[model samples]
Structures are given as structure tokens and as C-alpha cells.
Target: MLTMKNVTKVFRTEMVETHALRELTLEVKSGEFVAVTGPSGSGKTTFLNIAGLLDDFTGGEYRLDGVEVRQLGDRARSKLRNEKIGFVFQSFNLIPDLNLFDNVDVPLRYRGFTRGERRQRIERALERVGLASRIRHFPAELSGGQQQRVAIARAIAGDPKLLLADEPTGNLDSQMAREVMQLLEELNAGGTVVVIVTHDPEIAARAQRNVHIVDGVASHLDRGPALVSPALRTA
Candidate 1:
């Protein structure tokens, strides 16, 4: 679970002060899939970074998986992040030269897993994303959807408690987006807490909850699934 209370993030320069998040309060429970929708510069990215422990908040409190994260040192935070959080970015963030297996193996390497264990985890992650056979292909050799699936594989290889995705389907076509969404749905069903920041309302409808952010504040929209598909219902 994740919780943020009255969280404020300020980016101050010599010339001006920019408030990326103002009194932002949100909570994501275990096994929940939440979609974050916001306009440009509405602080969705900042919230994601803070929630993923990629950045620190200037004020308020945040707890992740029962640990208070307000003032942890960089080393401690990085350790916790690597242990508890996974991230998928819009850009895919894959190394073009590294094959699929190697790309997914990168994070496991940092965890100090042996070659055998790393291979095991890599295989499982890719299989979950339906990309096991493409493990030897480079990023450039794959379609956008395949590359994103590899990115998701890389994120889930650690078995993270929380998965944070930013614009996961931004680059894919409708069918590919649905495929990626289905993969995420399956992951959530298996109990990995998922948070996605996206601009597409239709995609947002697939999640359990939709949160709209504006002017650095977030409000949860009390509505049912955008469509009553069986997958969305169970997810």
C-alpha cells in the first residue's frame, strides 16, 4: 500500500518557485489499479516520481509498504526502491543494443542475483508478458507494443510490490494498447499494486479507479468502469 498526506513538492530556482504538487493527498491500496489523468504540467509525473521514490517531497509525509519515506537518505531510498517498486516509462527506456533477455536482466543484476536465478526471473517475466520467444531480439527488431511488453517485463522481473507506469500505451495503436492493458490487468489480478499515469480517458476507464489531477491537486472520480467488460470487472 502507498499513502501520501498533504504532500507538497516545490522546485525552487533563483528566479522563481514552481510548485509541482500542492497539498496532494492520495492512497493506493494493495491489489488496486488506479489511473491518473491530468493535463500538461498538472503534477502527475511529480507524484509518480515521489511515489516511486525517484524524488523527494519538500513537505508532508509518504509511506510505502509500511515504511515512512519522508527523510530516508539516498542510499536507503534507492535500496527500498529497488526492493519494492517497479517502473515502466513511455519511452520504453530499453537499451537498443541489449537483447530482450539482457534488458530484463539488468535490474536483476543490480539485485545481485546469480546467473541461474537471474535467468529464471528473466524467463518468468518475459513469459508473463508473452515475449519469451523474443528474448534474444533487440529493441529495434520489435514493434512498439513488443518493446513496451519488454519494458513491462523488465519492470516486473524484480517482483516489485508496486508498479508505476507513465503513459504505458502512449505510443501503441488501439489493439496493442489493449494487449498491454490486458497484461497489466493480469499482473494486477495476481496482486501487484499498479498505478498508471495516462492521458487517454478510454484507457483510464479500464482501471479500478480514475483520478483527475489539476493545478497540482488530485480528485478521485466516483464512477464505474468506463465499460463493463469482464476483464475490467474482474480487474
Candidate 2:
């Protein structure tokens, strides 16, 4: 679960000041799939960065899974982020030279997992993303969709409590995007909380809940029962 209260982020320069987020209060519960949609400059990325601990807010409180993120030191924040959160990015962020297996192995290596343990995690994660047989393939050799799946695999290898994706399907074709969305849905159904930042209405519509960001705050949120429409789940 995630909670934010009066979150504010400001960017300052010698001559100009910009407020990226202003008292943006948002919450995502366990097992929830949330889509954060907004126009450019609406602070969607700022919110995602703050939520994922990549950046600190200028003011307000943010708690992730009951831990106060705003108060933690950098080292502690890094540890918490690695342990509790997974990330998927728009650009796939894969190491160009590493094979699929090694790419997924990178994060687990930081955790001090032995070769056997890392191997197992990588295998399972790849299988979950439907990329088991392509473990030896390089990113350049795979299709865009396969590359994105590999990114998802890398994120899930740690068995994170929360998954944060930014423009996850932005580079893929419609069919590939749909497939990726379906995979995300499946992951959410299995109890991993997911929050995505997207501009596509169709992509946002697939999430169990939608939050529209405007002027550095959550402009709209549907507080209806946590109900996922049936159609969003199908391939």
C-alpha cells in the first residue's frame, strides 16, 4: 500500500521557479492496479519519481508499505526501494550488451544472491513473462514486445511488493501493447500492486482505477468499490 498527503515538488533556478507537484494526495491499496494519466507538464512523472523514491518531494509525507519514505536517508531509501519496489520503464532500459539472463541477473546480484538462487529467480521471472526460451537472446535480436517483456521480467525477479511502470507500452504496436497490458493485469491479479503513468486513454482505461493529474495534484479519482471490469482482463 502507498499513501501520500500534501505532496509538493518544486524546481528552482536562478531566474525561474516551477512547481511540478502541489499537495498531491493519492493512495493505492494492496492488489490495486492504478493508471495515472495526465497531459504533458501535469506532474505525472514527478509523482512517479516521488512515489518510487527516485526523487524526494519538497514537502508533504509519503509512506510506502507503512514506512515513511520522506524521512529515510539515501542509503536506507535505496535499500527499501530495491527490496520493496520494481520498475518498468518506457525505453526498456535493458543493457545493450547483456543477454536476457544476465540482464535479469543484474539486480539479484546486488542482493548477494548466489548463482543458483539468481538463476532460479531469473528463470521463473522470464517464464512468467513468456520468455523462457529466449533467455540467451540479446535485446537487439528480439522484437520490441519481447524486449519489454524482458524488462518486466527484470522488474519481477525480485518479487517486489509494488510495481511502478512509466509508459510501459509506449514503444510497441497496438497488439503488443495489449499483450503487455494483459501481462500487467495478470501480475496485478496475483497480488502485486501496480501503478502506471500513461497518456493513452485506452491504456488508462484498462486499469482497475484511474487518477488524472493536473497542476501538480491528483485531479480526479474514482472512489467507487475496488471493482475491475471483466473486459479489461481478457487478452
Candidate 3:
């Protein structure tokens, strides 16, 4: 559903040029769950930002669900991003004063859904994440895992075609991480394409495929066993 061909990202300063991605070519098919693993400063974040349309690439091409994003205007890109992509970040990114219901409702509102429709979506997304009972809870009232679930709920509330998660379990304990991963797996089983950027090997290994990045390039790609993946294992 997503394709990047010869994509290169360069950050330029007056004195230095930093290449975040070098001729990166990759494809994520519909319904696939793929993991991206790399060390700090390995361009995983840059790739995610580009994939999410949060930033632009300096060279090459990107096709998201068949539309070429390389030339899309900012307005068009923003609309497409809202309609086609969902993001789950390690920081949760929830508003402290917003309850779970409203947290999930925020993005839907941006999409101009009616109150009834937004409510339905918010409810369903929360239910899917096993947080239906906490819809009234605020961010400060929930644990780290629960807050992250709310973030996930907010992401999927729009029925996005692609889910991009960056270090989704980085802040959670083992039990919470497992719960979140299981939720992602369940979502993938139902046909939403999921791509995760993580440093945790065990989490990356659970995915159907793994992509490893080093020095601004994808150096390894693998499918199958967890032990064979390049990222460092945690327990």
C-alpha cells in the first residue's frame, strides 16, 4: 500500500549536510505488519516522518495507496495524511485536560464528522483497544499503558488505511507492551497495514517482516524467525 523508490532525505545546514535516508526503496503491501528497527540516528525516525507525510524527502518518489506524494501540495498532503494514515507515538501525545472520549474525538473532528458519527467511531476504537470503560478518564488518570491505548484509539478512530507506530511500547512495561502488541496484531489481522519503528528486538521480531537501517540506508530486510532479525533482543 506504500512504496518508496530511490527516496533520499537530506538535512542541510550552512556548514554541514546530513543524509537521513539514502536511496531508500521499500514497499508495504496491504494488510502487512512490518517492523523497522535501527539504532539511534539511523534514519528510522526520518523514514517514519516521510512516510507519515509529516516531512518531505529531498529526492526520489513515494506512493501511498497509489497516489504519488512527492509532488503533492501541503494541503493535499495533509488531507491525504488525515484520511489514509494513523500514528501512534511513544509519548502518547494526549491532551492532559481531554478525556479519553474527547482525545479520540479530536482527529475525527478535524475530518468534519458529525457528533453522532464521531461518537460511534470513538466508542468503537476505544472498545477495540479494551479501553471502553475508561472513556471518561483523563490522561493524568490513566497509567502509561492506558494512556498509550487512548493514543492508539485516537489514531484508529478515523479508520485509517495505514498505521505507523514509533516506539509504541518504549514507555511501557512488559505486560503493557504485550497488550499493545497484541492489539496491533489483532488490528493487522483485520486488514489494516501496520508499520512500527522500534528499538526493541522482541517487539520487532513479532512482526511479519523486519527492515533494518544503518547509516541512513536500509541494510537488511528479513522475514520469519525472531532470532534472525538484526535489532537487539530484550529478554
The candidate that achieves the highest TM-score relative to the unseen native structure: 3
Per residue, candidate 1 scores C-alpha lDDT tens digits across 1-235 of: 9999999999999999999999989989999999998998999999999999999899999999999998799888988998898888998999998999999998888888999999999999999899999989999999999999999999999999999999998998877877889888889999999999987777787888988899888899854654445543443
TM-score of 3: 0.94
lDDT of 3 by residue, 1-235 (tens): 9999999999999999999999999999999999999999999999999999999999999999999998899889989999999999999899998899989998898888999999999999999888999889899999999999999999899999999999999999877887788888888998999999998778888888898998889965675573543332232
TM-score, per-candidate, Cα-based: 0.94, 0.94, 0.94
lDDT of each: 0.90, 0.90, 0.90
Candidate 2 has an lDDT of 0.90
- Model 1 steric clash pairs: none
* Residue pairs with clashing backbones, model 2: none
Candidates ranked by TM-score: 3, 1, 2
Q: Would you give me the overall lDDT of model 3?
A: 0.90
In candidate 1, which residue ranges exceed 4 Å CA deviation?
A: 224-235
Give me the overall lDDT of model 1: 0.90
Model 2: per-residue lDDT, tens digit, 143-172?
999999999999999999999999999999
